[model samples]
Target: MVKRSRRFVAFFLAALALVLALAFVAADRWSRITARDNAELAAQSVARANQGLLVSELQKFRLLPLVLAEFPDVAEVLADANPEATAHLNAQLELLAGRTDAAVIYLIGRDGVTRAASNWRLRTSFVGQNYGFRPYFRGAMRDGASELFALGTVSGRPGLYLARRIDQNGRALGTIVVKVEFDRLEKAWGVDGGIGLVTDPHGVVLVTSRPAWRFKTTEPLSRRALEDAVRTLQFGPSPPARAPLSLSGSEASVGAGRRQEPYVAGTLPAPIDDGRLTALVPLQPFLEDARRVALLWGLAILLVAGAIVAVLLRQWDRQRMLLQSRAALSLEVERQTAELRDTNARLLVESQEREEATNKYVAAREDLARANRLGTLGQITAGVAHEINQPVAAIRTFAENSTKLITRSRPEDAQLNLGRIIALTERIASITSELRSFTRRKTPVPVQATLGSIVDGALLLLGAKASSQIEIAVSRADREHVLVGDRVRLEQVLINLLRNALDAVGKRPGAIQLTASAQGDRMTIRIVDRGPGIDPAIRERLFTPFETAKSGGLGLGLAIARDIAREFDGDLWLDPMEGPGAAFIVSLRIAR
Candidate 1:
């Protein structure tokens, strides 16, 4: 009997050891796989974040030229030919350059002499410099339009240049050049541990995230590692099949092992006048996290095994105790059963509370939906009022004219009055058609529409209040000539902005300027008012539902406006204007 028991124990120990060994091997393999997957995911997330930052910085860089092109002063200078305008233009350029991130804004005359420059320190140096031979200036003059250039440092700063030739009739007058600082481009990358570089097919790093390393002619071993990693990494759709691996060496080792790791990378072709953009990232952190998870799983398996062993030992001991006192065991079992019943009752009440909470959430969502519907209805009403008021006002004017003709007893004058009345009635019919289209419930239909029409409709709705005292200016220079959006929704947005501007002006004699323009694939609309702007105290809460500055205002106008904009993939924001006014800017993406 003793020998049999010992044999049994020996067999059990051997089986346990075999199970542990297998577990350890399987766990290690799984840990490595999980780590690799996690690392790849992390690298992909980083790459996407980096890409967004790059695009944002590029947009910022583009702003320098765009802003200059839209400046009223620049427009005025282009329209007029006064010789003294040079001094005024120089001063304006200098002011704009100081306020912006541009390194310089220089004007080159048709004769190739640098006429006026924003950079005063370089004014004398560039005055006689003949840049007519420069590609940027020459190309613009020849094309009669704007041109972009990417070349070595023109003013000791490696950057992009935007040049537009000033033209009157068919003759070129001068070229306006705006220089963007490349150092700012490095700042945009914001990659701390590793460096990012824009490379050509020849393996030349054209631009780098590190300012100190940008345009440097040094060929380091790390550069070779990066090149090799780029070549090895699949960067294709099947991320799992082509894991990224990092090269291990030197200071560049930070991104070295990235080649074997999984990552997301996309090669973007160059813009019309720029080079390609390639992004790289590492997956070390994600891999580490996966390894940690595997370790935790291994620990849990070991813990469960230990618990099974304890339960088996307890059961064996219980068998011995039951033999000694069966009656005592029965009493203990009953006590356990009673305790379980009490615990179950408590769980039931807790579940009930959770159900109630869920119901409340559903109710809240229903309320929000109702509120949105009502807000849409309000916008439609406002637009209808604006659209119809114009024709009604015209009819009023025509009626008064007819009455005067009748009083004068002039038959010919009366005939002209009748013609005007007929024209006014036709205009009224057009207004009704517009109102029907705007007010009717319909599905979202995107189409190309002019922003000027929307602005006109919005202003007409508020015309009764604006009248003669308040000046309204509409500028479509910045707006996209053709936009793809829901006409009714856009009209609603315009109406909200106009109403807000009218409210701001109140009884005060102020000017409201509405301007629109297209930048890249986006349309921007700015509504500026020279009335008592919003108070700083309530500025942050301006768009919050039920938050209002006016006594009778519902405070939902701006909130609803924001919702409509977002539904169409747009944004609305408020900021203090450059002058003494408030500026509200709405941005929407242009449909491709």
Candidate 2:
């Protein structure tokens, strides 16, 4: 047994350990997944914000070229090659560039020669430079308007160029260009710790918070693609390099060599250009938090398992002790059994006598309960007789009137009188039917009965006694509650309580209120009267047999009512209140 117990404990511990390990693994995986999703959402929000900022900046510079193209000086400069007009337009361009926050504004003739520039005073300027091969200038000349992001050949800085064709008499004269740089935007974007990149339609990093990432391909470029990029000079004379980041779906490995770190990456389209905005959020903090969460879960599971194991071990020890005591108990029981053999025979005889006495006691109790119910019926028999007499007299009068009407040759009136007689007869029958059902004696069989029906039946029985001063209100919901009790017996309980309340408030100005409500799995019926409260002397023994405050009263009504209540697993008692008047409450279980 000792070895078996040891083995059982060992197996339990092993199982518990395996469960703990599995819990840890599952918890870690779930936490990591949740963390990843949250990080992705944060990255997506950042990318959208960046895209909005980029689009707003580009839009501010977009109108500069269109407005400049409409200038008459611009058409004259391109058509006449006028140096004076060019010089004056250069200063105007300078002022417009400053007001619009544009990087530079320059004009290019149809031949692609720069006629004027906003930065003409600066050494690295576009004045007199030919841009015939530039995509923006060529596109503007062909389509009347165009936009391109490229590295400046003069300043070696990357910017977006918005261009529109200058027209003279509907003839294209030159192309007006506006440049927008993002140095300040990148600086602001980098203040918050995360990587940000703006990728062109071909997946080239046109702008980024990280300078080294600019003009780099987001993914590896093919040989032909690299050659095309270098030939077009979209980025620079040198071929665009691949970004250091390696992306796979939403995950990214940023940086290079030993410095590389994992990130949750998100990409979204930019509103202004055929471009994509990318934001990368670091995973270290989220991963650490996930680990902490997983660790907490593991600890919680371990504590619960340990507690269970301890309980099992304790029970095992108790079982072992019980086994040791069981043998001694067996021997003692055998000795006692032999000693009590004759005593048992005597006990059997005594038990039979006791059982007989108990049976008699139960019979007596039931007989007293039946007698009480009959006595209650007798008390109401006078009212019942009065009610029956009124209906009987009405029926006789209606019959006499019908006979007279028929004798007078008024057959329709006679038929109406006969119908009234039938209604009176029904009223008589209903009164008698209720009395018979109430006085009938049978074994109590509890069943699911609606409270509404019980209340209705009880009220019907007490209709003779219930006055307008006695207000009875049962809520629809409360009436719907089902009680587990004999319908007849339960009705008796309500009748007794309500009758007592009516007696208490007899000829009184105050009202007697009876209400029923359901609470949890129990139903409660309260009968409250505003008459003089119960005599304090009998308060304690209110439910005792033969206890009464009225003269010539049996006082068995409350006692029997309480007994019936208990028979069906219910209870009845007088509830104590501060002011005049008495309250009785009956509580019973609600059937599931």
* TM-scores, each model vs. reference: 0.40, 0.52
lDDT of 2 by residue, 392-506 (tens): 8888888899889999999999999888888888888877787787877777777657999888877666665454456768899888888988888888888787778777777
- Residue 529 deviation, candidate 1, in Å? 75
lDDT of 1 by residue, 271-343 (tens): 3244444444444554566667777887898798778766655665666677778787788889988988998
Off by over 4 Å in 1: 1-84, 109-113, 123-126, 130-154, 182-185, 191-208, 216-280, 309-592
In terms of lDDT, which candidate is strongest? 2
Q: What is the lDDT of residue 575 in candidate 2?
A: 89
Error of 1 at 129 (Å): 3.5
What are the candidates' C-alpha RMSDs? Answer: 32.0, 10.8
Among the numbered candidates, top TM-score falls to 2
